[model samples]
Target: MTTLNLPVVVSARTKWIQLFLGLVCMASISSPQYVWTLLTRPLAEKMGVGLAELQVTFSLLIILQTFFSPFQGKLIDRFGPRRLIAIGTLLSGLSWVLASQVTNLTGLYLAYGCLGGLGTGIVYVGVVGLMVRWFPQQRGLAAGAVAAGYGMGAILTTFPVANSLAAYGLEHTLWLFGAIFSLVGLLASQGLKAPLDEVTEPASRFVAQSSRQYRSGEMLRQPLFWLMFAMMAMMSTSGLMVTSQMAIFARDFGIADVVVFGMAALPLALTLDRFTNGLTRPLFGFISDRYGREKTMFIAFALEGCAMTLWLMSRDNAVLFVLLSGVVFFGWGEIFSLFPSTLTDTFGSRHATANYGWLYMSQGIGSILGGPLAALMYQYTGGWHLVFGCAIALDFITAGLALWVLQPWRRRFMQQQA
Candidate 1:
């Protein structure tokens, strides 16, 4: 394989540099999905669509980012990181540039939805896959660090994007930022290469627990993969629902414009949520590294479920709502780190990218249900209570599955393979 022939740079410091490069690449692509909420209202008005209809663009972006990830992952494995990620960076930037000129729904969907989705998917899966191989001793933390980039990268740009949209025309803002995203992302991607074997072969739970390397086909055949898929899909549904719908819900609840500490409540909540979301990945991933994956997952998932319930109860209180949203994200965002690390632990790292690609499809399934479907639920039910209730239910159910079912099943599956 390419990994074997790649020059084995034995220095541990170089691998950390690779991890940072991957982080930057991930950050470059994150705004497409993470900041989509900011564009929803203006885009809806400009395109003459309802909130639900406008959300379809968000759904498509996620669907393409996740659904096509397996192929993108496999390609990264074949072609190496630098080439593929550079292409993804350029495509992501171009998507926004193309989006700047669009006057209709079809054009918006094509540029922002299809192109943006594919581009971000490529960078996301590719960088994540690279991290797993590069830091074999700390797979969970490595994954979490890069995933944190995606979760929090928008923090630097959220206010800027919001301000630019208001101050300049949306088209001008999109074009200017798109150019920067493309240039910066491509430059970061150039620093990425497959890790040498010396860097990738450190002893870890991922290597310790797995009985054998499983190919993508074999991984698909295992019942364990499907169970993880279901759990991930459920988790993704709850998190994505909150992520895509939060701005709308805040507005509807009449707290979006309410200010605390001289800042609008909704944006402040979003900023806090981004912080918690980024923090949780490495926090919980480090916990899982020491305490076992299932235990950490159980705790975090239950926290999200309870946090959602509290958020709904305090809906009218802007301060509580803002605080609780951060709590909810703190509980939810770690799945990006946890699930991928868990999957590699079970299946081994030879096909890590491809295996994760299949697992990532659950996120796409979730984006469909969580983004547009959740919005539709609000439209039909005349309130967000029902939507929040459904998400809470899924959260608890998945938490139960993670603790009671996944732990035992994976243990047995690995034993049998051994």
Candidate 2:
């Protein structure tokens, strides 16, 4: 098979620079999904929609972002990151800009849900695939760092966005930030490209167990891939349920306006959650690098499960709520890093982007089950306990799967492939 070799030299320094560029691009596009919670109440009020109705936008964003990734991944492989990401950056920013002017649910859905989802999907899948190839020896770390940009990027904007929504109104804040994100993301995209063919060598810790490069179709035939997909869907559902609905629940619980460390608890929790979420990717990725991916998954996934339970038990205590929310994110955000790195390790980097795209679609399934469905559950139940209960159950199941099912299954599959 002939690899498409990069024309220019990519030194270690250059690779790091490429990763940084991807990081910045990912960070710039993060708020549309991550900060959706902050915008939920405002958008609902403005459009005269219910919480479950406003959440459709959130679900659409994840659905488009994850479901279309295989096509986006193929585009990245064909056209390269620079051009594709540029288009994505433009669309992402444009989504918010159009959203700022929307007067109804349909307009908001088109702007934030469809366009924003497509754009972020391109940037996300492209950057992750790029990282796996770029840092063959440190795939986990590379994936984690870029994923951290997405996971934690909202930290830089949370307070400012909350303040802007208060002082400048949602429309002005959306327009201003949208313009800035578009500019920054485009600039960052210019620095991205596929790694040199030579750098695509496999360097996973369990290198002796590696299989031949699998195309997207070949990958889909593997039972292991489906297992991972199921596990991803479960974890994604649990995490996204909290992520998309945190602010609403906090408000309903009467803790949203409570002061925590001189800032409103909701934004404060969000800021802290972003930090821990970002921190966990690299930290757990590094751990997975040495200790193994499934082990790390079991630990972190279980941590989230426990954190969610504790957070609910202590819902009335504002301070505990804020702290535990951070823990929950810390445990959950590593999924972005772990899943891609593991998929690339199992299937090989030849089709890393496209292969992971299929696995990533699990998030779309998860968004439906977790985002809108969870919201709907709350609407009917008139309480969040059912939603939290479902998430908690899935978390423990995924944690167990990571250890018992995923680990042994991967070992056996790779041994057979070898």
Q: How would you encode candidate 1's per-residue C-alpha lDDT over 149-199 as one tens digit per residue?
A: 999988888899999999997898889889989999999999899865444
Clashes of each: 0, 0
lDDT of 1: 0.88
Judge candidate 1 at residue 160 and give its lDDT. Answer: 91
lDDT value for model 2:
0.90
Angstrom error of the Cα, residue 256, model 1: value is 0.5
lDDT of 1 at 63: 93
The model with the greatest lDDT is 2
lDDT digits (tens) for residues 97-216 of candidate 2: 999999999999999999999999999999999888888778889999999999888899988898999999989999999999999999999988887565534365543335588989
Model 2 worst lDDT run, 10 consecutive residues: 200-209
Against the correct fold, how does model 1 do in TM-score?
Answer: 0.96
